[model samples]
Target: KVALQFEEDWKERVYDRRYVALAHGELPKSQGTVSSYLKDDSHYVTHSSQEDNGGKFAVTHYKKLKSGNGYSLVELQLETGRKNQIRVHLQDLGCPVVGDLKYGDGSDPIGRLGLHAYKLCFKHPVTGEDLKFTSDIPKAFSAVVEAI
Candidate 1:
């Protein structure tokens, strides 16, 4: 496995992150933002309920990429990286990532979590050079997305 390194100044740079997820259904809008307070109250799940109290702020912007057969492919950009932020926020929207049994309806169409980091960009800590990385979405994900 490849380990990702983060610098102390990472928060100062725009870390553009993107992921591909299979949602249970279509979202209310093609593109929108989800913001909430998230707390890790359980080892198996994250809580987004306001009553959880004094949780960390988290935000994610998502866009619907494709939809068919009771599922939709969504691209997400996270503004904060709180633990389980995406899963919790998406679940709050009532469309958790497919195969994410911890947060969603527990449907495993592809036999694994339908979440993948597709791209990441940020400034290099030492070189001060702009760096970017992109990864092709898994074939299983692409197949489902294109089938729509």
Candidate 2:
């Protein structure tokens, strides 16, 4: 027999999301934060410069883990989730994620988006205990990091 349980208000719980991205060019700093008001603009999201416009505030912190062969491995923590926040913010920093043609340099070395969600942390809904999950980086990502 098996049972499943969930918190009464689990949908409102907060979570931490971390991802690794292979980006083009070197980041300006080893680590930093990107904050912006993002709004949906058709196929993608864009920074909203106007205060009166409707947009969601997004923030992310990124660190350079490795760089070589015209590519840099960036580790990112999402403070606020907005559509395409990582891709847009990275592009704003002038280092788009490799293989992210819509929001990057348009190079598809691995034939897929160069972004991977490596970690997620949150409170367990039913038990109210801290829960953290991590996934191994895909071989493609590791290969790019090693190659560069």
Candidate 3:
């Protein structure tokens, strides 16, 4: 599907990729493309070999404001819409989004995907009005403001 739409190899254009779960559960560690991830700077599937990696998921153009353990901001258009596409994809590669249940540290007390539908800069679906709006980032994404 990606090749048909983008008309490109797509793989070479992959600046980063991963697999993440968007549902709640513990996944087997022996899954996903871990080898490629270790050698490729542009890939991160998840943390460690075992951890949950899902919950409201979204794929954004991830932008890390700092090195590992700092702040991160991923901005991405909705690719394959799914309850957990972002989380699932990230988990597939192996860096589930933070705070995710099916795809993050099980310690996450937060019950939502850190992802948000912020900054919708487009015309109104009706009324033909030009508009741009942004959804307030959930307080939970606090880890973001200081870095991005």
Candidate 4:
């Protein structure tokens, strides 16, 4: 994992494209996107000496890509690397990642957690070199999104 930074600078970008299991209502088609700081919860805990005052902040940006009968494909950019940040944020959004047993309704539509990292960009700390890597969205992901 990349070095965790709590600042909101967003210098390190981790973009994920995932399928979410929607409930009774679907995401607003016209809204296009949503972003906010993730509220602190027990899921953010880590092996550290710092006290848990519930002030730790995490930001996530979401863009709806497609809507199916009971699911939606979304692109998410995490500004903070808190543990389970994406899952927790999506859970709070009311439509958790599909197949996420800990956060969602545990609907295993894809037979696994519907989260995938498609891109990662960060500056090397010591060399100050810009580093970036990207991968194709999984075929299973595309199959699910296309069904929308």
Candidate 1 lowest-lDDT run of ten = 1-10
- Model 3, which residues run further than 4 Å from truth? 1-61, 66-71, 109-112, 138-148
In angstroms, give how far residue 52 of model 1 lies from its true place.
7.9
lDDT (tens digit, per residue) of candidate 1 on 1-148:
1123445556766469888888887788899998888777657467886553678888899999887777778889988888888888778888888898788999788889999998988877656688899998777865765674
- Tens digits of per-residue lDDT for model 3 on 122-148? 333334355555665565555443434
lDDT of each: 0.80, 0.81, 0.40, 0.58
Displacement of the residue 113 alpha carbon in candidate 2, Å:
0.2
- Candidates 3 and 4 compared: the better one by TM-score is 4
TM-score of 2: 0.84
List residue ranges in candidate 1 displaced over 4 A.
1-6, 42-44, 50-52, 145-148
**Stretches of model 4 off by over 4 angstroms after superposition:** 1-25, 29-53
Q: lDDT by residue for model 4 over 1-148, one digit each (tens)? A: 2344424434443233333323212555523333334444466432221234444566666777666666777777755566677776666666778777766787766787888777766566546566677776666655765664
Q: Could you estimate the TM-score for every candidate? A: 0.87, 0.84, 0.43, 0.66
List residue ranges in candidate 2 displaced over 4 A: 1-12, 43-45, 48-53
- Candidate 1 lDDT score relative to the true structure: 0.80
State in Å the error of residue 104, model 2.
1.2
